[model samples]
Target: MNGLSRLPRLYVDPTLVPTAQKGAPCLLTPEQARYLGTVLRKKVGEQVRVFHAGMGEWLASIAEIRKDRGGLVLERPLRAPQPCPPLPLAFALLKRDATDLVLRMGTELGVSEFLPLVTERTNTHRINPERLHAIAVEAAEQCERLDIPTIAQVQTLPALLGNWPHQTSLFAAIERLDKRENTLHLPTRQVQEGDGLLIGPEGGLSDNECQTLLKRPFVVPVSLGSLVLRADTAVVAGLALLGNGLRSAPVSSQ
Candidate 1:
């Protein structure tokens, strides 16, 4: 078989909770068993690629297949674990579907972390971290990324700003660019590691909130364009621009 036609890739726990090793049978969870047996219909000798968030990716072979039970014998390592760039996105909480879209697309775009914030104009503070986490995992699996972005708990804008790290740079998306004298223009420098992007609620940040954010030396107000954009649209556009910038910047040792 050609190299491209090899086994399917899957994410699994690396600890081998059931105890898996080279030449040893590694038990597959019931969900995994159904996926391989019923969904993929793989035979006993079929190859599979498995990876863990903590451990690296591996090449394994199907040892057995059954409706309720299945196993894959570990073979060799495929790739080593790599660290994701520290590009964190802090967005004000939106409605359910929009919020999910941000997490899904952000993961695909290589965002390292997600911070759900509650702003002055935010409509809701209720967020399900578990659901968002699942979305991130699915996105990473589809995008073939070795690491999943960390999803943080929902925090108020003030609380988020209060504990903001010292070294990280913050880019705040604002609506009224005409008001600010020092607005960040596009094609500005590339975003390095430890940089953050912040998007406001649907109606945008309040006057008082904007003032508060502007007072911080670390925060930089950024404009999307002349036309108004929806909260979700702004996220995709902003990440695309920032992702491109990150790709252009020279790799840093730190």
Candidate 2:
């Protein structure tokens, strides 16, 4: 018996498997089936594991591969469904290229959800959820993450803070005197089992936005570093600190 190891590295969409259910047989969509069965040369009885969004994980075996959908004869459950711990990014929108970069990096850095905001200085809040989801899927596939991150609908900074109920909120800031002196730190696993991080636009959050966050109960102002960074740069840099298994932090806290 070959123990189930992940082989659902979906390099293409059509080959992506449907979210496998626990202890219940499921079929891979046409595109995914063709890729696995035809393109990748996988066949009946092959063992593979597939993941759904925080539905724990699924164990399945290839039962049939056809021109359309592929069938999987699911076996006994391998692991209990694990929900993603709270992780959110309230980020301001930027230019097309910059936003895309932030979205991609943020996904790999393990942001459970994204809230795109249009601040005073932001260019647009034109978020492409589908494209972002695709980016996240690719990132998750490459990183061997058990699930794909969710891209929340775009919302304003004030709006997001208004309805805030859960999560430890973090404001990415390296500007205040004390903060510049080095009070900035990233989220620890234990500290962030249920927390969220905020990244401003390229121009940074406006004074009003900053003040609003400061007043919020859950928000904690944080700093990235000495130099001001571009929107995309801050996103990648900030998320790198907030999420784990990425490059090391630029500096240690005092």
Candidate 3:
């Protein structure tokens, strides 16, 4: 365990990772095998940290490394299991690269769930769930997050608002509102545990969409200042603004 802190970390599916007890052998995915063997040149007996949402993180020693498969022997626990907070981020679906950036950065920024909204001005409604989940897992692995963020299926703006929970307020960033008609400021208040942030598409939500959002009691209209930002950029900026309100403290690893 002396050098375990320096080992590469991998996010493993709980169902596939087996038990968490010491000396238990855990199986690795083919991609992980390639990554450890070919990519990182990891060999037998080298230690690594494997973690997941429900199982927390464990130190393990590489049992074997082959071209298409690998296994690790569990050594001990590093961090206790903790679920991600319900700080959901609802953003209008953008192009491929931008959407990927949103997923990666949003995960790094402590977003627990991603709500992809299809607004009136959205260019596309399709999302590759598998690809996005992979990006999130990779980002979580790099960011040292204990849990991965969940990505919701693509839905319309109205649909998202309809299914939204009543207890949590949804902070929506809608720019250039008539000062007379709009009174809500950006991040009106600090974000609570279950509160969320919503960013519109590149061109911003349509007039009708803005009206629809403003009408909702749970939706808090927000302004991101004078400068308009790209959809991806807005996601980062909006999360940064609202992060201060989060009540959960960061989990320290031993």
Candidate 4:
């Protein structure tokens, strides 16, 4: 995985590639192969982009093919793609349709990871990891992205904020600082470049959750708009805004 930055290209793997890297043979998983062969219709010697987490993105070329299994030749390196903009989205689970929509959008939006928070008022925290991974993989392939974002098991709201990572925390509270201007440049106002966000459940956050957030120095509460946003809408809207924040900031120094 440490070599990820040097290998952001497409690959064909017979066995699962635990980590993709320069000069490494990234075997496509059966699911990945099915998509490349049946859905994508890619053949041998076809060029593709592949990546491993934290290694950033890279490009690869197919060398051979055997049904839906094959080998890949790591080609010249692509310009170092930035480590996925340090944006993490934590939101409560929505109903079935809405939850699936959020999963799809979160991948496309480049969310680093998802923590499905179970709040006291959460209607259901039901989620299938396999199905969610399918959604994320399909979204990445369709979006022409090099990497697959991670999805963690659903966690309780209290447990999520209790031991916050030592970084900036942006709670996309439905009733906090309003407007895009508030979200813009918030990273500068808070901790550092790494920004994590949390959106409320459909019914919105309970008084205890909001108060718990307010007391944290790392947590800077912000709003998406004046009108109430559905759980899915808030996730997309917040990601779009936060993504823009990462794009506008000056490139980080290593």
lDDT of 3 by residue, 106-209 (tens): 99999999999888889898999999999999999998888999999989887898899988899988888645265544335556778999999989888888
Number of clashes found in candidate 3: 0
lDDT of 1 by residue, 1-254 (tens): 24723577777765552443567556687778888899999889888877766656678898988997888888876777775778899999999999999999899888898999999889999888878988887788777788889999889988888989867678888887677644454334347777889999999899888878877877767779988888988888888878777788887678
lDDT string, candidate 4, 1-254, tens digits? 34543322342222445444566666666656666677777787777766544444556776665556666655545545454555677888888788889889988888878788898779997888888877776676566565676788889976877766855666556564543233444443432356877888888888777767666767777777788888788888878777777677676579
Tell me each candidate's TM-score. Answer: 0.87, 0.74, 0.92, 0.75
| Candidate 1 to truth, TM | 0.87
- The lDDT leader among the candidates is 3
Worst 10 residues of 3 by lDDT: 178-187
Error of 1 at 47 (Å): 2.0
Count of clashing residue pairs in every prediction: 0, 7, 0, 15
Candidate 4 has an lDDT of 0.69
> How should the candidates be ordered by TM-score, best one leading?
3, 1, 4, 2
Q: lDDT tens string, model 2, 43-158?
A: 89886666565344566678888877787765655556564556778788888777777767876677788888878888886877888777777777666556666787888777
Span of 10 residues, lowest total lDDT, candidate 1: 181-190
RMSD of each: 3.0, 6.3, 3.6, 6.0
Candidate 1 stretches with Cα past 4 Å from truth are 1-6, 17-26, 181-190, 252-254
What's the residue-level lDDT of 185 in candidate 2? 47
The C-alpha local distance difference test score for the whole of candidate 2 amounts to 0.66
